[model samples]
Target chain A: MTSMDFLLLTKGPLFQIAIAIFALGMLVRLVEIFALGRPHNYAAARGGQLIPGLKTVYKRFNPDPGTFKRAPFDVIVGIIWHIGFVVALLLFIPHIELIKSMFGVTWPGLPNPVVDAVTAITLFALLATLIHRLTHPVKKFLSTPEDYLIWTVTFLPVLTGYLAYHRLINPYPLALGLHILAAEIFLIVLPFTKLTHIFTAFVARWYNGAIFGRKGVQS
Target chain B: MTEFSLERGLNALREEMDAPVASFFSSCVHCGLCATACPFYVETGDPKYTPIHKLEPMRLLWEQEYTLWGKLKSKLGLGKQVTDEMLEEWEPLLYDSCSMCGRCSMVCPVGNDIHYMIRKAREGMVASGHAPEGLIAASVRAVNTGSPMGLQWKTLDVQIKHVETATDLEVPIDKQGADYLVLLSSMEIINFPEYLEAITKIFDHAGVSWTLSQQCFEATNAGIQIGSKDIAATLVQRVVDAAESLGVKNVISPECGHAYTAIRWEGPNAIKRAYPFKVFHIIEVLDQLRAAGRIKTEGKEMDRLSMHDPCNLARKSGVIQQQRSLMDLVADNFVDLEEHGKFQWCCGAGGGVSSNERAEELKMAAFKRKKAQIEQVEPERMVTMCATCRTQLEEGLEEFNMDIPVVGLTEMIADHLVERDKPDDAAAKAGG
Candidate 1:
C-alpha cells in the first residue's frame, strides 16, 4: 500500500479498534483488580489511612533519599522520560489538535521548538533506559521479554512522531502514518502487557499507603 | 505430618491473592529500586535477592490464574509454570535473605509492598514444605509447646525466682485487673534474665501495677516468623486467653521485634477479632510512664551511646519516637545512627533468619550493613528495645571485635530510675 493508503487505514478502522480494545481492556482489568477486593483489616488503625493513601500517589513522584542515592541515574532518567512523554502527549500542537477533534476541547500547545526538544530528550531517555537494562546485571536479570517489548512499543511513537514533525526520515505522510500506527500498537498492547502499570501504579501506591499508613507507617 | 506438594504451594499462592497483591503484581515497573533498599541485595550484590524478584512464583501464579493474556499463554504452553523445584530454590530467598523489614516497600517507586508480598510468598513456601528445617521445627514447637524454644513454665518460674531475689521485690504473677500484663521472649529468659529484674525495679520505683502470667509468658510468635497464620493465631490466642482471664488493661510486648509485630499488628488479624485490651511495646509503655511523670530518673548515661531501631518496633509499628523520648530522658550522650528510626538497618537476624541454620553466614553478612552504620557513629555502646536485635547486635559486634556493649533500653531506663524517698512514694507515683 502507498503511504497515503496506510495513513487512511491507520486513521480509520485500525485506530477505532485500537481505542476500543484499549478502553474495554482497561475497564475489564481494572474491574477484576478491584473486584478481588481488599481484605478487611481487623487490627485497629494507628492513624488516618485515607489521607496517607492520597498523599502517596503524589509522594512517589520523588524518590526517597535512600533510593535516590543508590539509583540516581534511573531516577533522573525515569523522571525525564515521564515528563517528556506527558508533555509530548498533552502539550504538543498536533496532539492537542487531535484531542480537539475527538473531544471538542482545545488547549494551548507548546511551541514547535519546545515540543521538539522534549520529544528528542524523551526518546534519548528511553534509549538510555534500554541500554541500562541491557548493561546492568540486576536490571538484566529482572527484565523479561515483555519488558523489552513494552519499551519498543512505547518508544516508537515518539521517534516516528519526532521524525515526521522534523520531516527527516521519510515523506511527511509516511512518517506521520507510521507514528500513528506505532501509537495504535502501543494503545492496543498497553492494557494487556506490563504497560498496564500506567494506570495501576497510582492505585497500588494508594493501597500501600493506606495499609501502612493505617498502621502509622510512612511507607 | 502435613504432606508437601506443588499443588498445595500453588493453591496457597492463589489463596493469598487479594487486592493489594493483585495491584502490586500489576504495577511493578521492574525498575530494580527495591534491590537497592534491601540489605541482602545491597550487601551481597545478588539480583536473586531483589525484593520483587523474590516474589516471582507468586507473580507467575497471579499472571497465569488471573490475567487473560497469561491464561492464553498457559494454553499455548508459553507461560512459566511454578514448580516444586522453583519453590524449593526460592525457599532461601523468601526466608533466610529477607527480614521483612519493609525497607523495600518504602523505596518502591510504584509503591508496591515488596516486603508484604514476601510475607505472603512465604505462606506458599511453608505449605510446599520447602521452608527451612529450623523455622519448621520452631513453628512445630511453638504449636506443641508454649514456646518456640520449647521452654516450659518451670524454666520461667526459675527466672522469676531469680529476678525476685536479685531485686528484693516480688515479680507479680497472675494479678487480676493489673494495668499491664508483661510478656517475655525465650531470648530474654535465657540470655538476658536481667530484663525481668530491670522491669521489676522500674515498675516498683514507678509504682506501676503489672503482672506476668504463668499461663502465657512467651510473646515471640514462630507462626509469624515461619509465615503461617494458623500457627500464629494459635500462639496469639494463648496470650489473649490469659490476658482476658487476668482482666489486664494493657499487654506489654517484650523487647523482641517479631514478638511486637506478631502480637500488636498481626494478632488481631490472625484471630479475626479486635483485641479486648490494647497492646503496647515495652518502649511505648515506658514512654507513656515518662510522659505521665510516673517515671523519674536522676541521671543520664555518660558514655557515648547509639540506638538500633528494631524494624518491627520502629518501621512496622511506629514506636520510633517513643523510644527516642525514653532515650532522651536517660541517654545524655546518645547519638542517632545515620539511618535510625523508620529507616534503620536490620541486624540480619529477624523474620526467622536467626532460626534457620543455613542462613547464619548470610545473616552475618547482612549484619555488615548495621556494622558500618554503627562504625559511622562510633558509639561506645548500643541500646535497642528488641531482644532479637539486641542478640544480633551483641553477637555481630563481638564477631567484628568491637568492644561496644549492647544494652536493652528497658534495663538502661531501670538503671537510671530515681530512688523513692518513702515506702509510700511508690503509691504516690502511681497515683500522680
Candidate 2:
C-alpha cells in the first residue's frame, strides 16, 4: 500500500472502529456492574457517607504515609506517569484538533515544548515501571501475561506519538501512521484489560470510603 | 450428604459476584501494593500470601462466569480453570495466613477492598468443604450448644457466682425492661471472669441497668469466623430475640472485636433489618458514659502504658477513639503504639486464625509485626479491649518472652472506680 493509503486507513475506519468499541465496551461493563446492584446497608450510619466518599476520591491522590513508605517507587512513578500521560495526550495541539473534529469539543493546547517534555518524562516512567515489574519479586509474582500485554499497549501510543511528532523514523507519513495505529489498538483494548482501572478507580474509592465512612472510620 | 465438587465451589463463587466484587476484580492494577500492606507477606516475604493472590480462585471464577472475553478464553482452553485441587491448595492461604485485618484494603491504590473479597472467597471454601476442620467443628458446636467453645450458660452461671463473690455485687440476669442487654464471649466466660466483675462494679457505680440473658449471653459468632451467613444469622437471631424480649434499648458487646462486628455491624445485615435497639462496643459505651459524667475514677494506672487496637473494633467498627478516651481517663502515663488506632496492626489471631490449630505458627509469625510496634514504644503494660486480641497478645508476648502484662481495658477501668459507702448509695448518687 502507498504511504498515503496506509495513513488514510489508520486515521479513518480504524480510528472510528476503535472509538466505537472503546465507548461501547465501557458502557456495557459499567452497566453490568450496576445491574448487579449493591444491597442497601440497613445499619444506621455513625458518620455521614457522602462527604467521606467524596473525600476518598480526593484523598487517594495522596496516599497515606504507611503506604507511601512501603511502595515509594511504585507510588511516585505511578502518579508521575498518570499526570504526564493525561497532559501529554489530551493537551497536545494535534490531539485537540482530532477531538474537536470528532466530538465538537474545543480546548487550548499546551505549548509544543511543554508537551514534548511531559511525553519524554512519561515514557521514562513507563520504562521504570516495566523494570520494577521485572525486578521486584512481588510485582513479578502478581503479574500475569495480561498485565505485561496491557503495559505494552499503554506504553506504545505515547512512544509512537512522540516519535511521529519528531519525525525521527524516516518517512513522516509512515511514522505518523504507526502512531495512529498504536493509539487505535490501545483504545480498543482499554475496557477489556486492567486499563479499565482508569475509569473504575474513582467509583471503587468512593465505595470503599462510603463503607468505612458509614462506620465512622475515615478511609 | 452432598459431596464437595468443583461445580459446587464455582457456583458459590459465581453467586458472590456482586457489584463491589465485580468492580474490585476489574479495577485491581496488580501493583503489588497489597503485598506490602499485608503482614503475612511483609513478615514472611512470601509472594503467595499477597492479599490479591489469595483470591485467585475467586477471581478465576469471576472471569469464567462474568466476562465475555473470559468466556472466549475458557472456550479456547487458554483460561485457568478453578479445580477442586486448587481450592484445597488455597485453603491455607485464605484462612490460615489471613487475619482479615483490612490493612491491605486501606492501602490499595485502586481502592479494591481485598479484605471483603477474602470474606466472599471463604464462602466458596466452606461450600467446597475445603474449610479447616477446626472452623467446621467450631461452627457445628456454635449451632448445637450456643457457644463455639460448647460452654453452656451453666458455665457462665458458675463464673457469675465467682464474680458475685469477688465483687460483692449482684450480677443481674434476665431482668426485663433493663436499659441494656449485655453479652459475653466464651473466652470471657472461661478465661477472664474478671470482665464480668468489672462490668458489675462499673455499671453499679454508673447506675446503668443491665442484664445478662440466660437464653443468649455468648457474643462471639463462630459462624462469622467460619464464613457462613446462615449459621451466623442463626447465632445472631438468639441475641435479637433476647434483646426484643427483654425490651432493652441497647445491647453492649463485650471486649471482643469480632463479637462487636458480628452484633453491631454484620448482625442487622445478616437478619435483614435495622435493630430495634442500637448496639455498642463496650469501649463506645464506656466513652459515652464518661462523656456524660457517669463513670468516675479515683486513681490512675501508674506506669508507662500502651494499647493494642483490635482490628475488627478499631479498623472495622470505628471504635478507635472510644478506647483511647477511656484510656485517658484511668491511665496517667498513657502512650500509644506508633501504629495504634485505625491504622493499628492486627494481633494476628482474628478472623478465625486463632481457632485453626494449623495457623498457630503463622499467627505467631504475624505477631512479630505487633511485637515490633510494641517494642518501639517499650511500655511496661499493654491494654486492649478485645478478648481474642488479649488472648493473642498474652500468647504472643509469652512466646517472645516479653514481660509486658496485657490487661483488658474494661478491667483496668474497673480497678480504679471511686469508692462509695454502699452499692445502693453509689447507684443513687449516679442516678441523682
Candidate 3:
C-alpha cells in the first residue's frame, strides 16, 4: 500500500491495543480495592453533629489553635504542585490532541510559549521526584521495580512530546507515534502500580480529616 | 486463649512465617528519627528496639519477595537472613519490646505505621501460640470473665459499694436510662480506686445525669493490643450494649488510653453496627463542662501544667491535642511539652504491657524516657489523659521518687469543681 495507508494501519492497531491494555489495568485495580479491604473502624468519623465549640482535631492535632495558620510557602507549593500535576495529566496539549484524534472531539489550545513553560515545570518535577526516590533512604527502600517503571514511563511521553514539538528529531510523525505509545503505556500502568496513590491518598486524607472533623477537630 | 510453649512455639511460628513477614519487612528506613518518638528507643538508646526496627524481619521478607535485586539476592540466600532463632529473639524485640504507640508514624515521611506492622506480626505469632504466658492468660481472662483481673461478680459488687461510700456519690450497678454511662478500665477499679473517687466527684460536681454499670465496665480491651480483633470486638460489644440499654446520650471513657480508642475507633467493628450514643473520653467530658460553665476553675493555677502523651490516645486514637487544649482552658500554666500532639513521645505502657510480667522493666525504661522529657519543662505536675499512663507513670515515678503529682484530667477537674462557695453554716444547715 501507499505510505499514507501504512500510517493509517499503524494508528488503528496501536489504538486498539492501548484501549485493551487500559481496560485490563482498570479491572485489576478494582479487584485490589475491594478484595484487600482495610479495617475502617473509625466511629466518631462517621457521624455529623451540630457542635457549638472548637473542633476536637484542632485541640488534638495542634493543641494550640493559634499554630494552625498556614505559611505562604505551604499554600503556594501545595496549590501549585497539586493543580499543576492534575492539569498536566488532563489538559497537556499533545495528550489532549491524542484524545481529540481518538474520539473525534477537540478543544481550544494553549499559546505555544505557555505550553513550553508548563512542560518545563512538569519535567522539572519529574526529575526532582526521581532524585528524591534515589537519594532519600526511606523512599529508596520502600520503592520497587514497579515504582521505577512508573517513573520511567512518565518521563518518556513528556520528553518525546517536547522533541516532537520542536522537530528536534527531524521526522515529526515517527516522534509523534512514539509519544502516543508512551502515553498509552502510562495510562495502562497508572491504576495498577503505586501510581494508584493518586486515588488512595485522597481517600486516606479525607477519611482522616472527616473523622476528626466530625468531632469538631482539625483533620 | 491460644496457648503454646512460650519460647519454642514463638520460634516455630516465626519460622513458618519467616519468609512472608521478613520479606514484607524491608519497607522501613531506620533514620533514628523514630527513636525520638518512641519511649523505649529514647530511653534505652537501643536502635534495635525502635518501632521501625521491629519490622526488620518483615523487611527481610520484603527484600526477598518484592524487589528486583533483592529477589535475585535471595536466590543465593543473600538477602537479610531469616531463621527460627531470629524469630525467637524478636519476641521481646517486637512485642514485649515495643508499646505500639503509633508516634513513629507521625514522624515517618511516608506515614508508615511500623507499630501497626509490629502488632500484626505479634498477632501472627500469637495465632501460632507464640504470645507470652502472662499476656495470654490476661487475654484469656478478659475473653472468659469480663476483666483482666478476672474479678468475680461478687468482688465487683464490693468494689462498687466501696466506690459509692468513698465518694458519697452513687456508682450505679447495671442501671438503665442514665444520661451518661461511665465505663471504667478494670485497671482503675482493681489497681487504683483513687481514679474512681476522682471520676465520681466530677459526676457529682457537674450534676450530670450519669451512672456506672458494674457489668461491661472493663474499658481495657486486650484484644486490641494483642491484635486479636475478634476478642477486642467481643469485649467492646458488652459496653456498647450496656450504653444502649442505659439510653445515655454519651458513654464517657475513663482515663484509659486504649479503652477510649477501642470504644471510639473500634466500637463499630466490635458491635458490627453503630450506636447512636456518643462516646467521650473523660477528658473530653471534663473539657466540655469547663467550656460550658458547668464546672468553673478558681485559680487557673495549673496553666503551667506539662502533660505526658499517652500513646493510644495521642497517636492511635488522636486525642492528645484535645486533651492538651482542654488543659489549656483550665490552667494558666499550660506549658506545652516540646514533643506535643502527634509528635509527642509514647507513654511506653500501652499494647497490653501494663500488666505484663516484664512490666516493671519496661515501665522503668519507659519512665526514664518520659522523665527526661518532663525534666525539660519541669512543670508542677505531669497531667495525663489515660488511666493506664497515670498508673504506669506513677509506677515509673517511684524510681525517681519525686513528689510531683501524677493526675488524670478527671482528677484535675475534681480539684477545680467550683460550686459557688455555699455559705458554709447556712448550706450545711439547709442540706437542700
Candidate 4:
C-alpha cells in the first residue's frame, strides 16, 4: 500500500479493531480479578479502612523515604517516565484531539514544543529503564520474556510519536501511519500483558492499604 | 487420607486464590523494589531472595488457573505448571529466607503485598510435602503437644510458681471472670520466665484481673508459620475455647509477634467466626493501662534504649504507637533506630525461620540487616515487644558481638512500676 493508503488504514478500521480489543480485554481481565472475591475478614478491625484505602490509592504515587533510598534509581526513573508518559499521552494536541474525537471530550493541550521535550525525556527514561532491568540483579532475575516484550510495546508508541512529530522518516504519512499503528498495537496488547498494571495498580494499592489499615497501619 | 502430592499442592494454591492475590499478581511490574524491602535480599544481595521471585510458583499457578490467556496457554501445554520439583527448590526460598515480615508488602511500589502472596504460597508448599522439616516438626508439636517447642502446661506452671515466689504475687490460674486471659509462647516460658513475673507485677499494680489458662497457655501458632490453615484454625480454636470457658473479657497475646498476629488478627478468620473476647498485645494492654492512669511508675530506665518493632506487631497489627508510648513512660534515654515503628527491620527469625534448623545460616544472614540498623544507633540496650523478635535480637546481637542487651518492653515497664499500697486502692483511686 502507498503511504497515504497505509495512513488511512491505520487511522480507520485498524484503530477501531484495536480499541474494541483493548476495551473488551480490559473488561474481561477486570472481571476475572474482582470475580475471584476476597474472603470475608471475620476479625475485628483496629481502625477504619475506607479513608486509609483511598489515601493509599494516591499515596503510593510517591515511594516512602526508606524505599526511595534503597532503590533510588528505580524510583526516580519510574516516576519520571510515568509522569512524562502521562503528559505526552494527555497533554499533546494530536493525542488530545484523537481522545476528544473518540470520547467526545476535550481539554486544552500543552504547546507542541513542551510536549516534544517531554516525549524525548520519556523516551530516554524508558531506555534507561530497559538498561537498568538488564543490569540490576534483582530486576534482571525477576524479569521474563514478557517483561521485555511489554517494554517494547510500551516504548514503541512514544518513540514512533516522537519520530513522527519530527518527520524523521522520509515520507510524513508513513511516519504518522507507523505512530498510529504502534499505538494500536499498544492498546491491543496492554490488557494481556503486565501493562494491565495501568488499571490494576490502583486496585492493588487500595487492597493493600485497606488490609493494613484495618489493623490500624498507615501503609 | 490422600497423601501430599503435586495435584494436592496445585489444588491448595487454587483454593488460596482470592481477589487480593489476583489483583496483586496482575499489578506486579517486576521492578524488583520488593527486594529492597526484604531483609533476606537486602542483607544477602541475592536476586534469588527477591520476595516476588519467591512467589513465582504461586504466581504461575494463579496465571494458569485464573486468566483467559493463561488458561489458553495451559490447555495448549505452553504454560508452566507448579511441579513437585519446583516446590522442593523453593522450600528454602519460601521457608528459610522468608520471615513473612511484610516489609516487602510495605514497600512494593505497585502494592503487591508480596509477603502476603508468599504466605499463601506456603500452603501449597506444605500440601506438596515440601515444607521445611523444622517447620513440619513444629507444626506437629504444636498440634500434638500444644506448644511448638513441645512444652507442656506443667512447664509453664513451673514458671508461674517461680514468678509468684520472685514477685510475691499470686499467679492466677484459669481464673474465671478475669478481665484478661493471658497466652504465652513456648519461647517465653522456656527462655524468659521473667516475662511471667513482669506481667504478674504489672497486673497486680494495675489491679487488672488476669489469669493463665491451663487449657491453652501457648500462643504461638506453627500452623501459621507452616502455612496450614486447618492447623492454624485448630490452634486458634484452642485459645478460643480456653477464653470462652474462662469467660475472660479479653485475651492478651504475650511478648510474641506472630503469636499476637495469629491470635489477634488471623485467629477469628482462621476459625471462620468472630471472637467473643477481644485480643490485645501486651504492649497495647500496657499502653491502655498507661492511658487510663492504671500503670503508675516511679523510675525511668537510665540506659540508652531503642526498640525493634516486631513485623507482625508493628507492620502487620498496627501496634506501633502503643510500644512507643510505653517506651516514653519509663525510658529516660530512648533513641529510636533509624528505621523504627512500622518501618523497623525484623530481627530475622520470625514466621518460623527460627524454628527451621536448616534456615539457621540464612536466618543469621538476614540478621545482618537488623545488625546494621542496630549498629547505627549503638543503644546500651534494645527493647522489643515480641518474644520471637526479642530472642532473635538477643541472639543476633550476640552473634555479631554487639553488647546491646535485648529486653522485653513489658518487663521494662514492670521494672519501673511504682510501689503502692493495696493494688485495689490504686485501681479505685484511678477509677474515682
Better of 1 and 2 by lDDT: 1
Identify the CAPRI category of the predicted complex in candidate 3.
incorrect
Please state the error at residue A33 of candidate 3 in Å.
Answer: 2.1
Runs of candidate 1 exceeding 4 Å displacement: B424-432
Relative to the true structure, candidate 3 has a C-alpha RMSD (angstroms) of 7.7
Clashes of each: 1, 0, 32, 1
Top candidate when judged by DockQ against the true structure: 4
Query: Is model 1 an incorrect, acceptable, medium or high docking prediction?
Result: high
User: Chain B vs. true chain B: TM-score for each candidate?
Assistant: 0.97, 0.96, 0.83, 0.96
Candidate 3 scores an iRMS of 8.7
DockQ values per model: 0.80, 0.75, 0.08, 0.87
Instruction: Tell me the tens digit of each residue's lDDT in model 1 across B289-343.
Output: 8999999998889999999999998888888899889989998898999887777
- Candidate 4: residue B419 Cα off by (Å): 1.1
Q: How well does candidate 4 score on lDDT at residue B244? A: 96
Clashes of 4: 1
How do the residues B12-44 of candidate 4 rate in per-residue lDDT, one tens digit apiece? 999999998999999999999988998898889
Full candidate order by DockQ, most accurate first: 4, 1, 2, 3
Candidate 2 lDDT tens digits, A59-88? 888888888988999889999999999998
Winner of 2 and 4 under TM-score: 4
